[model samples]
Target: MANKVYNFSAGPSVLPEQALKEASAACIDFENSGISILSMSHRSKPIENMFAQTEQYLRELMGIPEDYDIVFLGGGCSLLFCMLPMNFLDQNATADYALTGVWANKAYKEAKQFGNALAACDTKSETYSRIDKNLKLSDNATYLHVTANNTIYGTEWHNFPKPKSGFLMADVSSDFLARKINVSDFGVVYGGAQKNISCAGVTVTIIKKGLLGKVNRTIPTMLNFQTHIDAANMFNTPPVFAVYVMNRTLKWLKDFGGVDAIEKVNRSKAALLYSALDNSKVFVGTAAKEDRSIMNVPFVFNKDVVAADKADDLAKEFLEFAKARGLQQLKGHRSVGGFRASIYNAMPVEGVQALVDCLGDFEKKVLG
Candidate 1:
């Protein structure tokens, strides 16, 4: 067994050990306030300070503009699927979605409930192996929504599409803060905190204030983005502990040289695994080389090495073998039926090397 285990789950995945340690201490006595962070009141001074710090850290890390408002809410990313259209899709314009993967498709479906929704570009026919650079949308499009990273299919938009008319909204759930991005390029950017940032229970949204109140229909108080923004993300009781942990994680990220430095490291880690896959005789990458995600690398046992009929059994065997060696959560999404190694920002390079070694060892055993 390896000396230490490395987690590679797609969501609710690995986080910085130091951040976890700090959070652990805060859980007992937050900021010496004589109460656990989990028990701290959302309306307290400490919690308010944490919220400001969290937003500031995010703004500094992502270069979010002053015109944008950052809000942390309780519902997961899926809830935003409905909330987005409710708040932004107008009666006269259509909500256009780039269907890159399952999540994008889900968002597009939700948009339909509000008004005219269009599938601007759908790659499902291609098994979502690649992202389309061009999208089909009419002149009256309200917004063009794109999923920046598709964790399930192991694809990412290396180059963002520029809409000729409407603003771009991105669901960056899987790749948030993994690399540097121009926050100004999108009208709204949102993601669940569990993937690359922190823990579950909090969803972060960065939206341009001008985009709100444009839809013709009235949105419910909670579904309205302006409500959270106007209330300073304290419309109701906030997810206190999750946001606190996120603040610590962001601090860790900043101390680790922020997104730019981490992007280089993330790319290096991904290259190590992708290079191994490229040279392997028994494994093949699922996503296209050009559109491959640096965070989630999904590969399958080569059909030549293991016949199609036996691929599932081989995958099962490989997962067990990997887990026994302390390489955990190496299984792919159920939809894909292969192996997905989600090497998020917190994953160390040594972990990737260990997984590479396991791949080689497993290939030898399978061949024998």
Candidate 2:
């Protein structure tokens, strides 16, 4: 701890320090190749090897099967919001979505614009504080789309619902590549790399080989998943720097025992913060315990000490206080009016313990 602050932004969030250092060293002349990854031609052997290794590492880290086509596409997960429907949704076929939070709603809205889409279940009325377990799937649905984690509302689906129809698709943007998951459960799993994998600029899409090519809709070449798959994700100039950094991060993950080890640390960090909230009289968690997200934890100050209108003020104060004490990005998203602490894979157990200690100290100083 060199008096540095911990970052917890939802996306474009924290990355492993070792990865950052390695990237910094390679920024100028990557392995003495005399060219930065950014300056290299996408078709060059050096860059090609980088791309191949990165893709292979990602597949190995996540245990992705050989049948799945792993493509590193440009544009964030938001782009897939449009591409998924364009590639999968036929004229008469409907897609079913489970709206758990802001991101899920965005995906649903985009899918509806392209073709018929239905919400299997939505918790908007309750401000997305919990997951809807009793969702009714459509028999005619071409695919069931769901967001595995709600970064803003701090809700996550620990156990995914089985779709009754054709295939299962998930936008695990915030939680993808963070924990151990069965790759066979989903036909398509896509995520923006900014959250747990790397920085912004690239999105990873894993699609089962046979599940594509059914849609009669004519998708643009760039937006089509098969285009990138056919080109080995070099269809256009990919996000070279971002992909390089992701490769470094994936290597770091493997060095640290991959997803299983990181997941244990994640669980411990989340448990510590949740325990602090549960034990403290000054704080209360907003999301349901069972459905709470391990990556992003949302909590509110006690109503008796902090009014609803002043909640923002209190949060701002807490942000400043935590910043001074080496904690960073603890403020919640604007959509949900509470404080959020995003403990992604990069966040260590010590950081969570420090946050818990800060909470106790703040409570003692302010409300005691």
Candidate 3:
């Protein structure tokens, strides 16, 4: 087996080692059920139990209200950008979007193509460095859409804004299933499972049971949230292996003391790395201090000391240096250049400390 390297990729990110090991065993022969999870029939009793158990575990872990229907659907969180509006928006219906970063912008654009979309608040002019508090929400909106964490910009809403009208909807792909949240606060919460839950093939949608089936748009059966809910997330051939892995992951999280326990570790990990950046003269965090994300941390060299012309080159150099030291995927997203370390739920606190130590060592060598 190859030595396990610390991975910080924003999506398809690191998973718990125990979960991986268990999945490896199950993939070979799932509970000695005489077939792999992938080989088993999606309609078979075994797979059905896996699906039901996974849903139950996730609901329990997140404290989802009995009024909510948790459905594992196809397509990523991006699909929800369209599905959400298609299911709720109609003539004269508008949705309020908080354009905080790239993901939110994309969601707004998609929703706008279908129906009226109002930008309640936009931080594009600020290069998405922070969230705008003085949001002008639409009074007649159907729902307020927001991305809880800006993965590329390394900014997050520590607390969600209060919308004046309509229910609150969030795309929390990067932070979903990671920590404790008041599920009752949201009308809809959706995420792609690639980051905190499982792999890339499955998307999770948790919505209020009675809120769907009101839109005038005639969506295809597969795209309809109500269809998926009615079928119990088994309408079509679901991502069997992905759901199995997610089930194992949820079990691991439960055994590890659920979201509350993991969130404490997440906070400590982020604090360690942010403290290291603050202490380093050569390195500075990119996001506003209060808006810094606990999941993704982007840092850059102080431009006063280092020329901006060399920022990209320096970032590339540091990425290679860290990779050689067993830190993988430290490069930031291409649109926003810098180094981003994604410390997800599965990433251990030791991994964060190692990265922090590497940052200090690099700063000392480059600027001391």
Candidate 4:
């Protein structure tokens, strides 16, 4: 068993050790200001500098275009769900949504309150095991919304869809900053900072300048993307400590060779676990092979090896077994009755190897 604990939580998940160390220090005296980041004013210079540097690092890492504007909001993607429809979906114009997973459904349902938002492709009936490539998006629709990664179901959209006439928008909460993305591919790319970027309380949004002013409805000042853009994401009081931590995380990522390098590492880690699952006699992955997520890997004890009625017991046993070896939060979502290994950016190859070894040991014991 490893001495260091490996966290597999989906969000509010693992962050780089360097970021955590620096953030801990900042809690007492941020940038020699003699005040904690939690106590610093949002309008202060240090906070402003932190915000700018975070955005700049994000821009460089993701190759975000100059035409796009970045902002950090108080609410996570849940808030962006309503904001998206209010700012873009006009009363006359319709928007299309890709029903990918739980979050996607929630976002789609939220959009229904603002305007006529239809599902371009729905995989709910199929248990969201794969990304539907053949999307029936309407050419005249205002925008097409897609969730880049399905956290619960362990599926990811490897290839993004293109809208004929309207722009594309994406909620990339679970997979944010985990890989390289083309900024020009979407009108908006937004997600919570907790997953692959920073801690909770702040959501990062990158919006294309051309998408605004298209909606005729009156959006509240805070809900309006333009408001934050004008204020540089300091319209009211921003989440100070979260942004400070995010800045540190971004700096760590930059020093670690940016998104491209981390992406290679991410892919390697995912491959190791998935390969183990593919060859395992005791475990079987839930998500479709083609659409498997690199960030989250959900699998269960093989029903063929263990009876369905006893699967839960076996899962519990395995979770306890893994936890004893310093693995934490390997439990799957309550809705998904198995185990999920969330190998986010901070999750190293060694951690994945530990999990793979644990899985193998458990498999042997189960078989024996």
Which pairs of residues collide in candidate 3?
none
**C-alpha RMSD (angstroms) for model 4:** 1.1
| Candidate 4 residue-wise lDDT, 38-157, digit = tens | 888888888888888888888898999899999888887799988888988887788999998899999999999988899989887887878888988886988899999999999999
Query: Against the unseen true structure, what C-alpha lDDT does each candidate score?
Result: 0.91, 0.88, 0.87, 0.90
Runs with alpha carbons beyond 4 Å of true place in candidate 4: none
Give candidate 2 misplaced runs (Cα > 4 Å).
none
TM-score of each: 0.98, 0.97, 0.97, 0.98
Rank candidates by lDDT, best first: 1, 4, 2, 3
TM-score of 3: 0.97
| Model 4: ten consecutive residues of lowest lDDT | 122-131
Q: Which 10 consecutive positions of candidate 1 have the poorest summed lDDT?
A: 87-96
Kindly report which residue pairs in candidate 1 clash with one another: none
lDDT of 2 by residue, 1-368 (tens): 55568887787899999989878877888878988766789899988998999999988989999999998977888989988999989878899999999889999999998788999999999889999989889988899998999999999989988999888899988997778889899999999999899889999999999888898877788988899999898888999889988999999999999999999889889989999999987788999988989999988898977788877777778878888889988887777766889999998888888899999988887775
As for candidate 4, its clashing pairs are: none
Candidate 3 residue lDDT tens string, 143-200? 8888998999999889998778878998889997666778888899988998988988
Kindly indicate the candidate among 1 and 4 with the higher lDDT.
1
Of 2 and 3, which scores higher on lDDT?
2
